[model samples]
Target: MKVVVRVKLLPSPEQAEALQATLHACNRAANAASGVAFTTGATHKFALQQHVYAALKVKFGLSAQPAVRVIGKVADAYTTRTAHLDKGLLGHKGSKRRARSEATPIRFRPDSAQPFDDRCLSWQLDARTVSIWTTRGRMKNLAFTGSPDQLKALAEHHQGESDLIVQDGMWFVSATCEVPEKPLNTEPTGFTGVDLGIVEIATTSTGQRHAGRILNRYRRRQNRLRAKLQKKNTKSTKRVLKRLRRRESRRARDVNHMISKSIVERAERTGHGIALEDLKGIRGRARQAKRNRYTLHSWSFAQLRDFLTYKARRAGVPVVVVDPAYSSQSCSECDHTSRRNRPSQAVFACTGCGVVMHADTNASRNLARRGEIVWNAGRSVSRPCPSL
Candidate 1:
C-alpha cells in the first residue's frame, strides 16, 4: 500500500524566496515544454525531453535533474489531459468545451507543485531538515516538521519522489511511503454490508449508522459565508476566502477517517469482511432537484469508500463490491422486489412480508446477503479438469 505523508517546511526568508523562484522557473519551463509537445505531437517523456531539456537548463536556470523532472511533469499533464478528453470528461464531440480544450496547449500555474527525486531532494530524517536543489543553488538545512507518526513513516518506508507544494503561503512536502499489506483473511465469519448515502453517510448491515447531519450543517454554514464573501468582493474578503478554501473539506476528511477506522476495527474484531455498494457512475446517472444538487455534488462518498478499502486491506479483512441496482427497493426478509418497499427515505416497509425496518439498514442487509453469495461462489472450484 502506498501512503502520502505531508510535512510542513519551515524555511527562512532567503530560503523561502529561493524555493518560490525555483517553483516559478520550473513551471515556466513546463509551459514551454508543453507548447513544444503540443506543436510537435511529442507527448512522450523522452521525446519531449529531447526538444526542451537543454533549453530548460539554460533559460530557466534549472539543473540537470530539475530540468528532466520539469519535462516529465509536462509530459504527464498532457497524458492526463488526453485521457480525460478521450473519456469525454471535457465534453461531447463538437461541443464548445471540447473544442476549446483541443485548440490550446496545457499550462501550469506558477506555484504548481514540482516533484523532486532522490538526486535533487535528500531527506535528513533524524535532523528534521532537508537538503534540496534550488534555482539559486543547492539549499541545505531546510527545517521541516510533522506528527510523530508521519515522521516515523517517512523514516521507515518513504520512497520515490516527493512533491513540493505551496498553498496559502505555506510550504509542504508530500512524501510517498510504501507500507506492506497484511495477508488476506480467506475465511471470514460473515460480511458486513455498508450502504452509503448523503443523509446517513454510512450504515452497516448490523444496524450501525454514521449520520451526516452535523457535517451537512457545517457545510451549509460555510456555503452561506462563502456567498457573502463573494458578494462583497473586497480584498480582505478574498483573503478570508482563500484562508477558508479547504476548511469544510478538511472537516469532512477527518470525519471519514474516524468513521472508516471504527467500521474496520469492528469488522476485524468480529472476523467479518466488508461489502460496499458499487456506485461508480451514480453522479452521471442520478438526477437531483435544484435544492439537492449542491448536497449531492459536495458529499465525498468516494473518499469514504477509499478509506474503508485501504483500512480493510491493512487489517487483513476481505472486501467485496456488490451490485446495488435494487438493493434499496428489494425486501431483505422475503426477497420481494418492489418500488413500494421504500415509500419513504427513512422507513422501509415490505408489502409482501410486512417487515418494517430502517431503509438504510434494509439495503445494507441485502448487500450483505449478496456479498456472501459472491464470496461463496469464488471459494468453489468444483469444475472438471481440462484435458491437456
Candidate 2:
C-alpha cells in the first residue's frame, strides 16, 4: 500500500550542494549505526538514530532529536514488505553503508500537519495550504508542489493534510494514512500468456509481440560510448560519460514503462489474468558463452519484471508467475519434453504431435496452461467455472 511519489526538487545550486552533503552524512551515520547494531545486538532504528544525532549535532549544530527522527525513518524502510527479499536486503545494506554516489535526499515525519481543511480531502488534493509552527513564528500556507496525480494519491490515502518541510532541498512528508484497498475479486474471462525473451522483449499468446530492437540499439550505443570514455580518460570524456549514463538509464526506464503499461492494458481490456514465467533465480541460473557475457549482463530483465508487477497491481489486474521449468523445451501441444523441441531460438516443434509454432508463442501457451492449473487449485466446487 505504500507508494513513492518522486517529485523534482527546484533548489538553488548552493542548496543542492548542501542537500548532497546532508545525504552523505546521513548515509555514513546510518552505516556506522548498522555496524554497531549488528555487533551489539541493539535495536536497528535506535542505533541508527543515535549515530545520526551525534553526527548532525557535531557537523551542523542541528538538534539531536530531529536528526534521530530522520535516521529512524531510514531504518523503518528496512521493515517494509517487498516481494523480492534481495532488494530489501540490498536496501538495508545501502541505508547503513551507501557508496558516495548512492546517497539521496530524504526526511521523516511522525504525523500529518494541521489546518483541518475539507477541500483537500474532498477533491483528493493535498492541502496546498497548511500552518507550521516554526521556531520564529507560524508559517502559513506554504505551497506543496509535486505531480498532481501523486498529490491526489497522497490525499486519498491521508485524511488529514500535512505540510512537508523542505530541509536541505528534500521534502519530508508523512507516510500515507490509509492503506490501499485490496484488489477487487472478479472472475477472469480468459488468460493472457506472456513470454519474456532476450530478443523479443515480450510475446503474447494472442500473437502480439514487442520487439527489443530499440532497447538493444540503445544499449549497444551506451557500451560504445563507455568504451570510448574509458580509453580517452579526459575531463570532457568524463562529462560525456556522465551524460550518456543518465540518458541510457532514462531511456531504459521509459521503454520498460511503455512495455509494462501496454501489457497491463491488454489484459484489462480482455478481462484476463496475466500469466508469466516465474523467473526466480533466473539471472543466477543463466548460462552465457564467453562472448555473450556483456549482452547477458546488460539485459534489464529484473527491471522489466518489476515494472510489470507494479503496473498490474495499480491496474487492479492479477499477474501470476508460473514455474518456468522446461517452458521453452516442453511441447505445448503433445506435452512432449526434450531439448529437440526447440531446434532454434525462434522455432518450436513438438516431436510427438508434429506441432510447429513460434518459440515464444509455445512458451506463452505453456505459461497459460500453468496459470489454469493454479487457478483451478484455488477454485471451489460451489464457484462457477470461467468461460474460456
Candidate 3:
C-alpha cells in the first residue's frame, strides 16, 4: 500500500527558495508538455513523455535522469487518466482538454536535502528512524528526527503509510499504510443510508446527521476575503487570497475526515454497509435545475462519497452506491412512490401507506433496502430483517 508521511520542513530561507524554484520549474515543464500533447493529438503516454523530456532538457536544462523521472511521472498520470476515461470512471471532456498533471517534484521528510528514490517512491518509517532511497544513493536514520512516540502516533493514526509528494504548492502524501488485501468482513445485517446535503453535510439512514455549519462559516469567510481581494487587485490582496484558499481547504479536509471517520466507525460497529447515491450525473442534472441549482452545486456529495468509500474500505466495511431514482420520494414502509411523499425538506408523508417520517430518515431507509438487495444478490444469504 502507498502512504505519504508529511513533516514540516525546518529549512533555511535559501533552501526554501530553492525548493520553490524547483517546484515552479516542474510545473512549467508539466504544463508545456500538456499543451504539446493536446495540440498534437498525442494522448498516448510515450508521446507525452518524449515531449516532456525534450522540454526539460532544452528549456529547463535538467540532466538525463531527472528529465526521465519527470517525464515518467507525467506519462504515468496520462496513462492513469486515459484508463479512467476509457472505463467511464472519469468525466467526459472536450477534445481540446489539456492534462495538468501534478507530481511529487521534491521530497521533504526524514530531514531535508535527502533525494527520493525514483523507482521505489516510498519510504519505511519506524519508531526511531525513516529509510529513504534514490537511484544513486540511500539514506538511513537521518538524524534530528521528531519524537518517536509522536511519529508512532502519527503512523498509527494514518495506518502505517509513508510517502510525500509535492504538487501545486501542497504536499500530497499517502496518509495510510497497510491496505488490507480484503476489506474487513461485514455482514449485510443493516444498511447505513447517508444523504449528502449542503447545509447538513450528511444525514445517515440511522437518524444520525452531521452539520457543516462550521465548514460553511469558513467558506463564507473565504468567499468574502476573495471578493475583497479581487476588488483591491493588489499584490498583498493576492497573497491574502492564497492563504485563504489554503485555510479553506484545510478546514474542509478536516471536516471531511471527521465526518467520514464517524460514518465508518458507525458502520463497522453495526456490522452494516453504507448506502449512498451514485451522483455521477449530478453536475449535468444540476445545470438544468436553474434557480434551485445552488442546492446541488453547494453539495460536496462527491467528496463525501469518496471519503466514505476509502474510509469504509480501510475499516473492512462495505459501501453500496444505489440508484437514487426515487429514494427521496419513495415511502420506506409500503414501497409507495410518488412526488407527494417528500412534501418538504424534512417531512416525508406517504399517500398510499399513511406513513410519515423524517425525510432524511425515510431516504436512508430506502437506501438500506437497496443495499440489502445488492448484498443478497452478491451473497446467497437469507434476507436480513430491516432495522430502521
Best by TM-score: 1
In model 1, the runs with Cα more than 4 Å from the true position are: 385-388
| Top model number, lDDT | 1
Off by over 4 Å in 2: 24-40, 44-60, 73-148, 154-182, 380-388
Over the stretch 171-220, how does candidate 3's per-residue lDDT look in tens digits?
A: 33333434343456656578888877666788888878888777777777
Candidate 1 per-residue lDDT over residues 63-106, each given as its tens digit: 99999999989989988999999999999999999999999999
- Count of residue pairs whose backbone atoms collide, per candidate: 0, 2, 10
lDDT, candidate 3, equals 0.64
TM-score for candidate 3, residues paired by index: 0.71
- Candidate 3 Cα outliers beyond 4 Å, as residue runs: 24-67, 78-115, 118-150, 153-176, 181-183, 287-295, 380-388
lDDT of 1 at 196: 98
Report, for every candidate in turn, its global Cα lDDT versus the true structure.
0.94, 0.64, 0.64
Candidate number with the higher lDDT (1 or 3): 1
Q: When superposed on Cα atoms, how far off is each prediction in RMSD? A: 1.9, 8.0, 7.6
Candidate 1 lDDT (Cα, 0 to 1): 0.94
